[model samples]
Target: MTQSGFDTDRPVRLGVQLAPQHHDSYQVIRDAVSRLEDMGVDILFNWDHFFPLSGDPDGTHFEGWSMLAAWAEQTERVEFAALVNCNSYRNADLQADMARTIDHISKKGGETGRFIFGTGSGWFERDYTEYGYEFGTAGQRLDALAEALPRIESRWAQLNPEPTRDIPILIGGAGEQKTLRLVARHADIWHSFVSPDELPHKLEVLSRWADKEQRDTSTLVLSNELGRRDEAEARKLHDAGVRLFTHGVSGPDIDFDSVQRWLDWRDGING
Candidate 1:
């Protein structure tokens, strides 16, 4: 049961964040995408960043959206997106249009495009500073995200062929005041980095925000990172209501063994 003392009918899903960093060849990432989809993970994520987020500060890193476009064409079954696309990096309407185009690219034989629009308020200052965007306050970024989301949705409505489906919006962050409120109003998935002990309070706050927004909280899927988590801890997290879990894998090389472990865990949990 969750913090709300209930269980959801939603099936468990596994996502892996394939960081577009520390790689010499884009082909390495391309190959990783093909193998991961074949391995049966449900979702694939690449973060929106200009440079390597870990290891060497100046290591080779690829831009995220273009890689996502490649992923859209490369993988058939798995949904893909930026783990959390930064709201500060692009124009809202333009973001919408780009997403719509990718949505079309991922379509197969009338199946809706396999894209998830996971987004967040911009946080990494280097991405903004190096790219010539203003590195504003966190609150301002959050406010910008809140404003831009509606514009994105509106633009999607006017697009030519339209998104293959109502592309699910996944919002990352657990800030109760602004982030949770935004999640209540807009997110289909709420991804958090907090520990299981902290999730209940956040969910309680989300419940309040959902009430304020007059939205049903039950439809909201909770997602958490599975980095360094063992099965017992993961089960605790699952009981606390997180159904979607994503483990991050970085390059020079993708961790196929760890990916297999997660798939095994996903199957075990679902069964």
Candidate 2:
């Protein structure tokens, strides 16, 4: 797999979100991983949520890190991660150690860049309160994330056998005051839940912040969720210079057919 950067040969990439919450989970995700890799999807993402974001409030949900570990071992091609790992769930050091473990799993047979550490300041109130963690204010969580990112980066270096490649950091959020600014400084990939009309302004702001930080705006992998399965919509984002497009499906019994269609579209566009 190619390491994501300004010069990656692929002009656009498509990823699928296997929502760990609200799923048959174990089997649903396991099968999904192999199928996606076989179908040639670029990345597999699972949201970090303790409770099902949709469906029953008390539905079965698997933990993110462990699922990712399994995915690392199970799949040979696709890169995987929590679409946005909740920063409030684990300490910085522990998260780094877990990431290192996953990196090893993905590279067991040989070195392959099949993991991306996508993280964010957690927003769900239920996750923290139910898990006995402090449900601090948004600002507090973002501050913790800003501090933790460097530590996670440092810990990767400290590991005896380093990652297969420089583990790319994917940060998610659109908070202009804090999140986007941090993205400008630290993110290898920045994901946002924004509408088509709103993206141009956010891109401009991100570009300005990159200028101030002396970072190349193009260096950041711009990712966003595809709200609908419209080819034109995906192309619109690509035209705006967004290269990574993501679509999500819940489990219990996922419809991989739709995801396959998106993958086809991705290939057709890039081809």
Candidate 3:
């Protein structure tokens, strides 16, 4: 196993984020889920938000956790979760319980389980304003997340049936001081939005925090956005220690062309 938490001998993995917005119906999202799974994508993700992040502000959108519950029962082989769950929307204990429930729900035909608890401090102020959540400052939200994570873990330990498996906690953020510190302390996977050129520096900062926390960050999986970046660009990120590449596709017309390209790229590398 490498220091990046990803096994160097294992195959590279591809993930697709089916943004649950601009879709006229749930059936569209459901079909995309099935197709992505059948295509052998490693993980599926949806964002935790109340409205659309792009295009029209009030466009057709679905709630994240509920859709995830439906996805749990709908898919058989693929792991799924919010690309980054909003930590401020729900109680920390409730979030833990919800993730545990989804973990069990996703198990099928003797399969262990498939749930990654990807979360971050809440952003998208519109989600807060319209939903009645307090839109606190960024630092305040990060502090809340720092305090809540341990409680979430504690609640998971106390849950009745327990999770089918140890749910992997994925924290998404690139904030050097607090976010990376929390990642060192709790996350099994750390996701960032930075480009290939910016990753090494961030990793260095993360390593410093890991040393301070006495945590082996080398075992932490590194993730980056797979957005319009071509295969060549992706290889640079891979060389920088990123193993999981995720592409976010918006709805109404969920295109798989880019996803297919990345999957092909992943296969070429793995082979």
Top candidate when judged by TM-score against the true structure: 1
The sequence of per-residue lDDT tens digits that candidate 1 reaches over residues 85-140 is 99999999999999999998999765699889999998999999988999989999
Model 3 lDDT per residue over 1-271, tens place: 1335333444578889999999989999998999999998999999999999999989999999999999999999999989899999999999999999999998998657799999999899999998899988999999999999999999989999898887899999999999999999999888888888888789889889988999976578888898778888888888888888899999878888777888889999888
Tens digits of per-residue lDDT for model 2 on 1-271? 2222332344788888888766654786787778888989889998778788888889888888888888888888788878989998999989998888788888856656578999999998988998999988999999999999989989999998887788888999998888888888888888877766677788778777777888875578888898663788667767666778888988677888898888888888888
lDDT of each: 0.90, 0.82, 0.89
Per-residue lDDT for 158 in model 2?
Answer: 95
What are the models' TM-scores?
A: 0.97, 0.93, 0.96
Candidate 1 displacement at residue 34 in angstroms? 0.6
Which residues of candidate 1, in runs, are more than 4 Å off? 5-7
For candidate 2, the clash count comes to 1
lDDT of prediction 1: 0.90
Instruction: Rank the candidate models, highest TM-score first.
Output: 1, 3, 2
Looking at model 1, report the run of 10 residues with the lowest lDDT sum.
Answer: 1-10
For candidate 3, the per-residue lDDT at 86 reads: 97
